[model samples]
Target: MSDTVDETASGAATDPVLQRLSTLDRFLPIWIGVAMAVGLLLGRLVDGLDDALAAVEVGSVSLPIAIGLLIMMYPVLARVRYDELGHVTSDTRMLGASILLNWVLGPALMFALAWLLLPDLPEYRTGLIIVGLARCIAMVLIWNDLACGDREAAAILVAINAVFQILAFAFLGYFYLQVLPGWLGLEQTALDVSVWGIAKSVLVFLGIPLLAGFLTRTLGERARGRDWYESTFLPRIGPAALYGLLFTIVLLFALQGDTITSQPLDVARIAVPLLAYFVLMWGGAMLLTRALGFDYPRATAVSFTAAGNNFELAIAVAIGVFGVTSGQALAGVVGPLIEVPALVGLVYVSLWARRFFRDAPSTDPAVPDTGATR
Candidate 1:
């Protein structure tokens, strides 16, 4: 059986799949909107708030954002059954497809779209390419879990991407930004990025939360037993994922609120390609995985993983390599702005599409059923 994410609690009142969502999950779009507005307002109104948050002393990582991301990711990671991770690791089809989607098709698609859509905007184009290179390591888990995806599979895929990012990000950045463009007879931009710099992002953003979650799960299960850990501890910690997500959204946008608010036109321009990329990547991943005969949970997990980008890493790389005020940074900032709402909407889309999977599990939280790896 597949050890997928158990999103809803037992005895949930809402019977329908969508209605089974808690109030927080139910109104996620609204909360995300409110968070975005509040962040933008804070950045615009408050003096030096953006600068202060941006100046955190975590080296490549921002402390405030780190806090929220760690909080956001820990619960989902903790929810993973490490013992069952073996099941996911053995699924060569999912693993191979994840690598192809995240590393190969994902970056190549972004390069084409960036060149095709924003030819004149070099900085933003470069920024979008960087976003595509940095695969989802932080927020994809939340989206996957919320969509009722395979928990262990998502965790395994995320970890693999993190390791791959550390190794390939700099090389890919150089190739795409300079080598590929030159080969294509387009304007080539050189990126002076270090492998360590990208590796630091992986360590801080993903490594910390991953370690914490592993420890929490190992300890919690050992001390409390699996039944107690699953039923009691997991339910309590599960809600923290959304809380961290909302908190991170607020800070992420707040740090760039002034930029987002003042430059509406540029934000919109950067957003167009980003919105398209998210939808296309997600939809394409879902379709490809489904065609491979994956069940809903596994397909959903892979789709979310492939579709999401590591905005945190992208923004950091852009700002660090291209300067904070560069157009690249702005493009990176605009990524989550488009991605948050888009992915949230896609969650509902995934739920709706579950009807097509004959082996789909009972999405209604009112009924308790575990799914198997198909």
Candidate 2:
């Protein structure tokens, strides 16, 4: 079992598509920084462009960003094998732990960190809470695969998070941003958040892509066969999400370039809690996996999934609930900039941690050892 898993993972790691993706992930921070610089430069050179883009809004959501959001989310949602979600019931303990970590403990931790770290910066705090509320759905798969984690388990978790986000994100956003701050006696600005508005944003951002992805995969596979869809079709379109991500970042920073440049400290302030949140969540989840006696692959999957946030959804909702030029949106823009490098570093840490559990037995029969000591 372990050898078969090792062979499969090794083959995947060497595949051309994954290699291209790995190369992209390796220089992700550089790409983001370049995007920021380009956006700032454009913002300075073309004074009217930002205004023009900002003007194209419907119900607070920027049209260009909305398009980018849909493009970014579709590839991710399309890649998810929703049928595998049934496997979640077979591993109830892991599923329960993941849910607890992602929805409950994860959000609570970010709320505490945002408050503890940014007492005065209400907008930035709200941004952190928004990120916390939106759990991982897309990027965790890449992180998990890199760490030799159980891909099936990762897929199940991704599906679960996606469904949960559609259901709970708005209410949690309201609770944490509106009610909790008041209850905790923290000074908060009057955030005009409507549950219906948030629900609409989720539906537009996640729900539509989800439906489209489901239909695309179901129809495409039925027509062309699963092998061709997985190998040929998926690789061709998978990079669309990353492209959309970079475009969104450029547009976001282009819109808010002046604010970011003038108040550099504010960017740093938002980054601090975000950095802390990633490390804490990764560490906490790693320890939890160890406590649960999961093997290295399963442990890495749980830890990476818990550590990474669904920044795409967070950014969309931030722009929708707040405005494109709002400070909350700026903070949302800053999240992926901080997260990619941090999580990549944690990927290396996970590799090292794998050595410690290399000989440990897997609690779940579904996960094989994988001999993943690369």
Candidate 3:
């Protein structure tokens, strides 16, 4: 980690959080916009990458998405210090808030919003809902880390939510579409959620990387010096992950660029529900953290718990389950389009709101004082 990152991770006010926010504020939009353009251009250059993507699979899982998720996840795992998990877990308030916001509240709110707003667009409705239910597992950690959240709290929440999402993703899809009429579709809904299939993919995409991260951390402690790992390996994770993400984005947009080019209107339509979802999630999280008396890091974790979406997992699952041709797949693709920008915005909001809770009493400076846990 850089000196800037160390300060932010240490919870100092004059850390990378402010600088990152400032840099991202100035550069992210341009880079993301450039990403969109270059992605489209590069995406077009390789006409059959999407079709080639179809062949790269492990059993029922898609290879591209699996690889992408792994690349996206491992870097995050590299950043996690399991020691922090113990320290952060001791502060129950932050932990409790993180769990509730991510597992329970985030999915429910997303399902409800997608149901209410997406019905009119028959082609895209289910996809939108699926994307919504698949609340962010990895990027939330990234954003939380960026915002100077309690690392342990964020990691625990990430680990727990990831476990649940794998087990529940397919069931949630079935229930929301076929089983639960109020949340989304009615009797006419005929969507199939492959619980086992999703679980397997989760294993490959989430479980493997997480296990690898744990092993690396454990082994690195005894086999290698902490200084060597942090100094040589940790610093590289940020750029490598960023590169992987951009590459993944390029491939995804390339796969969907034709569709996007043909239907410019779809962008606006998808943006509406996504925007609303982010806004509602942010406001709800802020209120919940405040009402719960969460201190800074914990509240920020809760805020990101709601704010981020695992578009990578969602897209992969959508494609595997619904077929690439379905609108659900399209919705999953649309997720990153909206999410990248929205998360950046949420990061800003979390940082700006830091002053409000900075001095509030808490058990640990590392952990926030959300009332429920601590």
Candidate 4:
């Protein structure tokens, strides 16, 4: 329930956004890199480390991985202000754009890219589609905040996406992996996964954490107050999400280190499509919202929301559905790895693009103008 993290980020930016990050959050890529190295070394040097880690299992998930997955997701989900779902629902323009961009365009774009770019690599392709389907719940808030986007709007969009994900991710997984591929004459996933199977995994992994987060926020706020529950409590637990992410990454990479290290080109191959997806998604979202006359903050919020993926859930589902050594899990791990820097660059792009919006002068880190859009 309590832990501390040194928030960190890459590079030196005198911008307040960069300064706001703690050493831990700032150095996320570095941390993941180190974890990858440690895992690879462990896997390479220690004969039975992977086996030992995988030996203990619960409900088909290795105990260590299960712990990491839950710890990784719970805090992030708890931070989402689920009760505030109504706050931005009234903004039809913004909401519509986000819905189209996130649920429709976002996943479709990833599916196209994965298949088009890595047709020969079904594992990576399926993994990319899973990454796309997971959508952004936890990380988009940070990216939006970093870009000085709307807080309430970010929360609402993230909350909405999380709710839809529990129902839609599996169906989308089934569609992209099975139905769509078959229609396109592409080779489907080797594993015969079903919608219910994916749904069950989603329920256990995302549903448990989602419900736990809801109850925690509700009870914590009722017991204390909003300020204590958020300001006092959330920060302590928040760091564990990344820490848990790193823990799982280490184990996952450990299991597949030989493959990852031997075929460095595979990571590169995975990275190219991902890089294109982020840039295209973010840039396209920004332009679309701007064309729709959204203010800078709203545009930034919507753009980041559209661009980021829920890699935690994606990794969980990939490993759950495809097994740890599967390339799908490896591809899932590469998501946030590439996303971190890509979105950071887009933050600068967002800040720079402010001039294109009429509300450029209103770009302030606050709750945003809550006037209900007529």
Q: Top TM-score: which candidate number? A: 1
- The lDDT leader among the candidates is 1
Q: Residues 185-301, candidate 3: write the lDDT tens digits.
A: 364456666666656655676678788888887887777778777655665565555555656666667767766666668767877888888878877888788887777777777
Report the C-alpha lDDT of model 1 over 1-374, residue by residue, as the tens digit.
12333434342234357765666676889999999999999989999998899787464667898899988988888878888788789999999999999999999999999999999999999999999998999999988877878888899999999999988998998899999988889999888888887788788878888888889889988898999887767776777788889999998888999988989999998998999999999999999988999888889889999999999889888988899889999999999999999999998899778756646445323121212111
lDDT of 4 at 202: 47
The CA-based lDDT of model 3 is what? 0.66
State TM-scores per candidate.
Answer: 0.92, 0.76, 0.83, 0.72
Candidate 2 on 1-374: residue-level lDDT in tens?
A: 12122323465446322232245654666776788688877766777877877788643556787787677767666765667656645887788889989999999999999889988877888888888987877556656755557766786676678778767876787788778778878665444445565456556665677789889889989999887876667667767766776787677667667766777788899999999999999999988988887777667777888888977667767776688677788888788768876887786677556645644344332222212211
For candidate 3, the per-residue lDDT at 354 reads: 75
For candidate 3, the per-residue lDDT at 187 reads: 40
Alpha-carbon lDDT, every model: 0.85, 0.71, 0.66, 0.73
Pairs of colliding residues, candidate 3: 92-373, 93-373, 93-374, 127-328, 136-309, 136-310, 292-371, 294-369, 294-370, 295-369
Sorted on lDDT, best first, the list reads: 1, 4, 2, 3
TM-score, ranked from best to worst: 1, 3, 2, 4
The window of 10 residues in a row where model 3 has the poorest summed lDDT is 365-374
lDDT of the structure predicted as candidate 2: 0.71
Off by over 4 Å in 3: 1-17, 20-26, 58-65, 182-188, 359-374
